[model samples]
Target: MPVRHTDPPPAPSRAPSSVPETPARTRSQKVADSPSLMAIVAIAAVGVLLYTVFLFDFGHRGDWPAYLLVVVAESFIVVQALISLWTILSSGHDPRDYTFNEAQRALYGNQVEQTMAIGIGMRHAEMQLNDFPITVDVFITTYGEALADIRKTVEAAVAMDGAHTTYVLDDGKSAAVRDLARELGAEYVAREGNAHAKAGNVNHALSITTGDLFVILDADFVARPDFLHETVPFFADPTVAFVQTPQTYGNLRGLISRGAGYMQTVFYKFTQPGKNRFNAAFCVGTNVVFRRTAVMEIGGIWQESKSEDVWTSMKLHERGWRSIFIGTELAVGHTPETIETYTKQQLRWATGGFEILFRANPMGRGRALTLDQRLQYFGTATFYLVGIAPGLLLLVPPLQIYFGIAPISQDVPGLTWFFYYAGFYFMQIVVALFTIGSFRWETLLLATASFPIYVKAFANALLRRDQAWSVTGQKGVRNSPFTFIVPQVLAFVFLLATSVVGVWQAQLDRAFSLAVFWNILNTLVLGAFVVTALKESREIARASRELRALRRAGREPVGEHDEKVVTPVLPEPREERRAVAIKPVTPVPPPRPAIAATQAVAAVPRRHRAVAVRGPAPRPATRPTPLPPLRPAAPRPPAPVLPSQSGPPSISGPLPGLPIGGGPGRARRSAGGPRAAEEPEPRTAPVPVVPSPRRRSASGADLAAEVLSFSGDSFSGDAPARRRDRRSR
Candidate 1:
């Protein structure tokens, strides 16, 4: 949750009402984060230095081919480590300083309100620039995403607490989406063709909508109510071209989603903040705010490449426009939850990096980037190349297994090699722990499994062609995840065979081989990814089978999407159900003189007459959970006496109707004068039944039914009215 923050300004300032503010880093957090970051850099620097020393030692060289491969891969790894450490060292910068905060405070003034009716009669706070109201267009770019997801994003975009127009740019030409936009009161944008894919969709919106500053949110990214307040203030700096927030996600339910999210978590939390110091923070196609003039100056958003975001940002940077990347999560959406989506996403991003590295190098001629920007962009270009190293490194064990060849000279003891290896790789894990908070094994698995994607992206860039893929994963008919991870399966099989041979060789020699162990571990790592894909494949097949069954039975109609995609789920255990079945519950106090609540165990309040939450029905084989003994209700408070009353009012049937066992009747101030003041008409009370020997335990619903069905003859009442009131209650 966001907190309220107020800082005394040097001069007094006026604002319209109040706004929720992002939490500011406390002095303790600043103190703790700095030391932790430096520690990581220090430890990582020493490890890389020692590993480089061990690698370059001439005496450790073995076979030329294997040795050269090892050196090249390790060199790239070392370069990546150096860049990461440098970035971590510069992670102390916060783009949102006093200026940004002050600008945010003055974003809405009380002098003149700027209101636009959006989203079913919703209006927002004034969006001001220099205390003058400014126009902002919030664009949600969609291309074949689910309509429900798009609706959520559009609703949020319109409801944002700022005077802005929300538009849904539907590149899929979806009529349903257009209707949804109309129903939501958001403008609908459709184009004749998706010439440049997402970039074209946005550019088309740019042509007609004339907002001074525009925000771009992906179809699934839902902006927060204060998103405009957060990013719009950064543009107060005239030179700032855009404000980019991290692409945070809320749907981390699938393994693929978790792995893909973890892969970028560090970049958003640590690297982007560090990049902001160099004014090299780039837009990521979503959750970004761009100045219209800066974008117009760079022509429309660059549409030649798949990654128009980085390409456009490069053009803006070359044009000498500054960019800001805030580390805050202003909007959240879903990350790729399937192998096909993950592969396509990674491929596109990597291709963009390589294209920038080659076609229009930031470090090359005809550019106006500073030294800091040059180094940061160069790092970005080479980041994906580091992914290629893992694929090459996986082959080292096989080299030793197939032929008696090794990267390290036999003269070097195994222990020395292990120590040097640990210094680099083990220390990297420690660095991840410090920087990313906790080390995630899923990240490692995804990283290792995704090398083929990077390799394919590089190949596509090298060939100057697109990696055309018409995957069918998101309609009624779905493709198996295995279709996308063929390389991983082949690699796993080869490594497994190599490990088997290595194991046999070790057995024949009556000795242990580190190569066999390493090969086996790598094989298992790959196997885990294959297993994940297999699980997804099974889910897709199961969904297809169920859809077919539904169609055959004529119980459901055909549709473009199978809403019931069988996600991987585990069943609840029997113990939880038993516990829930035996749990106790009591009603909260009512506004009456007779039935006051008791402080019994597990007495749930009746805010809405809560149905005690319980798990599924328990099994007969499981141990019977005996219900706890019921406690007696507390005595009702004595009715207050009115000074006008002559004597104590005559009592009627015991308290109009206890919820348990007491018969139905209304208690009164006098026998027939009038009912108690502020009292509602009487209803049938409940019955409390002691458990029979045959009963194991009782569920809340069963007990509540018994309590409401009480027909006890203890008190006098009209039988028909009592039964009718009981049924209704």
Candidate 2:
């Protein structure tokens, strides 16, 4: 649905009346409606049928067994391809599915109204002046995160608008962490043991603090100022146990971050929303708000497993509580910057997910989850188990080529197989890119590259190995050698060697060429992963060096240039200096004595106003010198006034109390010597223009003495002497 902005309704009683007319929907919509998609699927289907019927000459083919296997594999691929198309198309049929990019707001009208009602109820509750304010407790769990990183998140959390208190659960028990919490005015809590890692630390917090609502934030994930306002209101429905917002990463400069982010895009944007339709949106470890009562009722965060978030959500759902997936990302964090960290993070999550699947299966008997909910949990658990497929797919072709064990007989027509496979592959890629937000072809390469990590995780889970949680080193250079990507490297090598041998042997029949083409293609895909791993390692090293440089320079490290996370929403409290250095010369003009008196009077106590306003005035020793009067110019006749008329201009006037236009001893000169007053006289000496003094070079003592002497005596006393000195010069 398109969102249109307009003036809000003046009255709440009236419905929103200015919204644009909604577009009409088609009477029926189906997968076939998409001509391009249908064309690919149809082509793929026909190609598969052609290959199965005409290409497979089992009687004469030397590699008949391998050819038969290839046929079966292609058939399986076609089936899964169709299933994917069906799933994607069917997903859109439900009105509940929403993406962060665009939302069908009309479908969530009831949820919006209830959320508004929650706000209204809070306002009414406040009006009653009751003792209870909805208290929200935010827990930031950290092991050994940098203080600078933690400061940004903690500051933002404290700045969040609500009746809330932030707690820094320092599992590492670092004094620096404690001091930072103190500096930020947040409560700091530490535990004595690391029994269940972050989950245990949170449980410890639950035992100590109390609040109506609880929020869990990873050490690096920073919440928006309005996070509580946006998420907490959903709890108005008593059944809502928690609200989960998408966890977005702020930095995506590195290959590792970009690739990992692509994988997350699918889950948060597509899978989570689909799960929300059935109220099966499981909690993602952070950026989530939970009802305190609901958590306590569910026995706190499940301490038995590292995937406590999933287990706890399951328990809550089983107890008839609800969860909401807000699809919107109101918080942002950092992604693992190195291949090793990324792999380790994936391994831990994969292992834990499988642990939940085995130990506390949601589909177990007597569980209260609906059939849909059970399937959702099962699907989530099995997600980690399916990592082995890419590895197997990578292996089959290379092994068949090198060992002369072709998966399909040469009797099979290669073009039909290739056409069908290509069609399905193309359509699937298109649909995924259209549905999921981030649709990069490079992401497919990255996904296929991560096969080794998945295989290792699966192996760990299969062996029932008890894995402990190891914090993902959020930002650092951990040398992830090519060895970490052994699977891709080895696969690429095998495929390359096998392709060379097959071409050299000149088994260049259509089927042989097809097999070579498929192996080479898979090899290239695996090679892309190898290159990405190398790039990721180099990026991690560069990032680490840059980070260190920034720190040494006393500057904050840069993340995404445009989308930096939690940049200290509320600035750190500026340190107050005990003594402020006042410049010798102030910029502000000094207040006049009279105006200052008035201001002092206004500020002083009533009885002291008179004393403040009229404090004893300093007595003047001598009266101020009166300025000289202006002398009118003597007129010439009705003719021009000659230079003689303007006699030598007086640069200095007579001192105060002296006669105007003349000294006490000198007589004034007339314009003409008592005779030819009507005629103009010749120009006399040009008026002497004495320049102003260039600089004052008086010493401090002399300057002080001059000021005192001037204040004590008038300039009249020295006027004649100064005139004599000027004349001598």
Candidate 3:
């Protein structure tokens, strides 16, 4: 069972009013006292003493070599044990590691209030000074990973609800991967060359993208939608640079995978929380959110170190930037299954750690690394080098007995030496078990088994070989050849045979017999590690055959019971989404009393009028030119006078010298003056009617004179004159 961390003392800085301040609880009150724990510690101490005193022996005074061998082996154990004991005791005093389980959280009275306070901070950060939404970029780095595996992670990221964008930083530059990103509705960025592996890939991505806060996820790690919700609130503090969550590998299966996962659990649960107390908690490379400014300040994620995450964290801390490690498992991933993959993974970590120690020593003349931080970093950096002790200890006894060479010339007292050696070892285990909150024998065995690999890693790191990144064994497993274990196997066999022959010889003294037995135990331990490797390879081969058979039968491998393991297919790309602008609703003002049309017009400006007219201009005019004067008529022969029946008076000779329809009674005015009508002209021309022949035609002047006379007599506007003329005609 995982133990909850006791709440640390409240900070002097005021927590948000929303997060009610609470007094800290003592560790004893927080953790219920357990009798079983006390019992285990007592039993372990007794067992160590009894085993050392009775089962093992110090040789006679003549056997000086036996003493030397025991001292050499014990020296490494004592130093490491002392370091572990001190760390555990100090860490347990004020634990920062915790579980989020309900019962555990109840120990902190203000958890809910703290949660609300964080939520409020998130709201503030989300709304910038100008109130525009903050941009968050989620970058999933990939290099030729299976699309199906990465697609799940991408889909999860896209499903997150926030002002965030998800990009797949593909270093492989595969067209198929680009299509996959498009299909999943994620932006895909590919670099031409992998300059510095993952760190370089991320730096290149950082250059092109613009986001206020960025999240990093490995291609296989699927994030919870609420990852930002839980994490971003912590960044409300200006000092916080990044937030790291546990890399929970929930998909691990089989013994090897489970064992590897357990080791991770110990680190995330115990080791990381302890580091957080010193403000030395480093990024674990994935499922971490970093402030853009913080990353930029660190010179773009430290390209020099293979373990960029640690180096980045060290630099950031040195620069006074703070980091946070949340114990929640918000994202999950896979662990290496096969022995070869597992060893490679461990070696890579070991190599990177040593590289940091030598190339850029955190403990050396660094800027602002605190004393506690230096020790913490030193312990981590030198962990792989310590594996050398186990290898040397395993070889010590076999060589001592095989050749008559001894490093010591005299033996020491048995009970005193046993008390010193066994007591240190047992006390270390007790403190570790108590401090870590839980212990698993399998985890210890796994660490013990990896000693040979660590020995090789230490050598490699010293030689500065294998500095580049290699893919972890989470990929498909292969049948591991036993060639990798030949040295280990030889050591195991030599030790076992040496112990048996020494026992059979009967010339060996009690001290020599005890040495043989110790060698026997070392052989078994080494053999167990070899067996683990062999079994892992065999299991992978078996799983491969089973998978192939299932594939041939046109069925996917079942996950649980008869249920199928279905991989999510990428959704089709959606049409571009246009942002819908929303207009604000405002209250309508009440209308004033209606105004008259004239008043309304008066109130309006001329420019604002519906239609406005400019001033009218007068047009110029001129008198019509006088029509050409009517020409005088030409002389013509008079028409034959028609004999007239006498009614009023006889008219003849085409009514000469008068208008065509002018009344005979009307007076006419010559150009000189008005004249009275001339009534009785000579009427001797009243002869019989006869047709007159055609005579000389009238000139144009005569027609013109006739038209003018008609116009003057008929078209003239004198109504009475015209009526009288009609009556007479």
Q: Which stretches of candidate 3 lie over 4 Å from their true place?
A: 1-133, 404-410, 435-439, 474-483, 506-512, 539-575, 578-729
Pairs of colliding residues, candidate 3: 64-408, 64-409, 64-410
Model 2 pairs whose backbones collide: 55-411, 55-412, 55-413, 66-406, 66-407, 66-408, 67-407, 67-408, 67-409, 70-407
lDDT of 1 by residue, 1-729 (tens): 111111111111224433556656743236336776687678879999998999999899988778888998888889888887787677677788787888787877652232222222113454666554456778888766777778888888877766677777765656577667767767666555456677766765554444568899988877777778788988777678899988777777777888888888667777777887788888888999997766755556777678789888988888777899876667878778888888888898899889888888878977788998888888888899888888988988889888878999999998999899998998888877766666778878888889999999888888788654222122234678888888999999999989889989999999878888988989999999998998898888898888789988987753423222121111111121212212244431222223323421123212111111111221122111221111123332332221111112231222221111111122222111112232233333533445343232667654444433353322223435655764565
Per-residue alpha-carbon lDDT of model 3 for 135-203, expressed as tens digits? 467888877566677888888777653446677876666556666667776776654456678887776
Per-residue accuracy of model 2 over 397-442 as CA lDDT, tens digit each:
6556667676554665667546645655665565555445236665
Candidate 3, residue 28: lDDT: 28
lDDT of candidates 1 onward, in order: 0.66, 0.55, 0.55
Q: What's the TM-score of every candidate structure? A: 0.72, 0.60, 0.62
Q: How close is candidate 1 to the true structure, as a TM-score?
A: 0.72
How high is the lDDT of residue 60 in model 3? 30
Q: What's model 1's lDDT at 281?
A: 80
> Candidate 3's error at 442, in angstroms?
2.8
Any residue pairs clashing in model 1, and if so which?
659-686, 661-686, 661-687, 686-707
